[model samples]
Target: MYYSRKRLMDDLPEEVTAIWSCTNEKCNGWMRDNFVLSARPTCVQCNSFMEKGEKLLPVLENANHKQSK
Candidate 1:
């Protein structure tokens, strides 16, 4: 018998979103803007400074992250 696995949900289309990219040339660390906890976030992988940038990513929401007033 042959079987095939299928995904439960359809793949979401990618969208351009704000992000923070690692300043370290050797590091490929990045984070979504809405997911950051600080005004200026650092790279979690290499602890390097991050700069503003944009990336094509699937739509995601951080329900647990509360925005500062």
Candidate 2:
């Protein structure tokens, strides 16, 4: 499974910030990256690994704006 660096970067969403957290309930860890350029980052906090197939939630922005004043 060889992928060109440029091609891989292009395939990922620009807004896909931070890698998904380890699903292990006992392990509370996450990988932070630009998403587009990030290959695979291990969770050092828990040593619980996360892979590409793992589910992930988008890091929402403008959360404060959504709140009603």
Candidate 3:
């Protein structure tokens, strides 16, 4: 017997969210602003300085994440 699988399409809409992007041109690292624990977060992948930017991404919430004082 042969079985067929169906592909599902994501219906969530994308929203503009604040993010931190790596300053290094060679590195393509970024993180959501709401998830950042530090006031000034560095790139976790390349250890480079990060700058504020915006991106169109799916809605996400970090209810458990706490900010460092």
Candidate 4:
């Protein structure tokens, strides 16, 4: 009887930056540069290996670490 609402989330700002993309064909996974682990970063979606790539994405940050300057 009613139409569905579009765009549920807020319009987050995005920019071009380096990221890791899932290598799996059936999976769509990606992580920000400042969010991946240095030792061995892996895709959390399908547990597959990720490759470095550049894409236009929203700026991401680690909420766990306190910003102390």
Candidate 5:
């Protein structure tokens, strides 16, 4: 008999917030959320890897309010 751990649908982590575009003026590329077992995530756009999305700081904060100074 084989027992496979069942994951409850509701138990899954919340949806990841996607970082839209790059913050660097030289290359404002788009990015996607990445997940790793240990820690750290990489920007799909610029490949500017980070441990967590939050660590990116103002770079990832460039969501809708792009024009703001």
Candidate 6:
């Protein structure tokens, strides 16, 4: 019998939004704009300055955000 498990990440919504991408060619890091609180965000991977752009990435909820009662 063959067992194939489904990945939870694959089921996430593919919502397009603005994000920051690493300027460094060696680094492949990015952050969602809604998740970041900065006019100029930096790269989390190589500590380099990030560039603004849009991508069709999965929609993720910010865990740091406070939920309303």
- Give the best candidate by TM-score: 3
Cand. 1 TM to true fold: 0.77
lDDT tens per residue, model 3, 30-51: 9999988888999999999999
Question: Could you give candidate 6's per-residue lDDT for residues 1-69 as a string of tens digits?
Answer: 664455666677897888889999999999887777777888877889998899998777788755331
Expressed as tens digits, the lDDT of each residue in 21-61 for candidate 4 is 89999999988766776645788989998898999876676
Cα RMSD, each candidate: 3.3, 12.4, 3.7, 5.1, 12.9, 4.4
Candidate 1 residue pairs that clash: none
Those runs of model 5 whose alpha carbons end farther than 4 Å from true positions after fitting are: 1-17, 34-69
Evaluate all candidate structures by whole-model CA lDDT and list the values in order: 0.86, 0.53, 0.87, 0.75, 0.42, 0.81
Model 2, position 38: C-alpha lDDT score? 35
Residue 62, model 2: Cα distance from true site in angstroms? 17
Q: Name the 10 consecutive residues with the lowest summed lDDT in model 2.
A: 60-69
**Which scores better on lDDT, 1 or 4?**
1
Report the number of clashing residue pairs per model. Answer: 0, 0, 0, 0, 0, 0
1 or 6, greater by lDDT: 1
Candidate 4 ranges with C-alpha deviation above 4 Å: 1-13, 60-69
Per-model TM against the reference: 0.77, 0.34, 0.80, 0.61, 0.23, 0.67
Candidate order, lDDT descending: 3, 1, 6, 4, 2, 5
Model 1 misplaced stretches (Cα beyond 4 Å):
1-10
2 or 3, greater by TM-score? 3
lDDT (Cα, 0-100) at 12 in candidate 1:
65
Residue 66 displacement (Å), model 4: 9.4
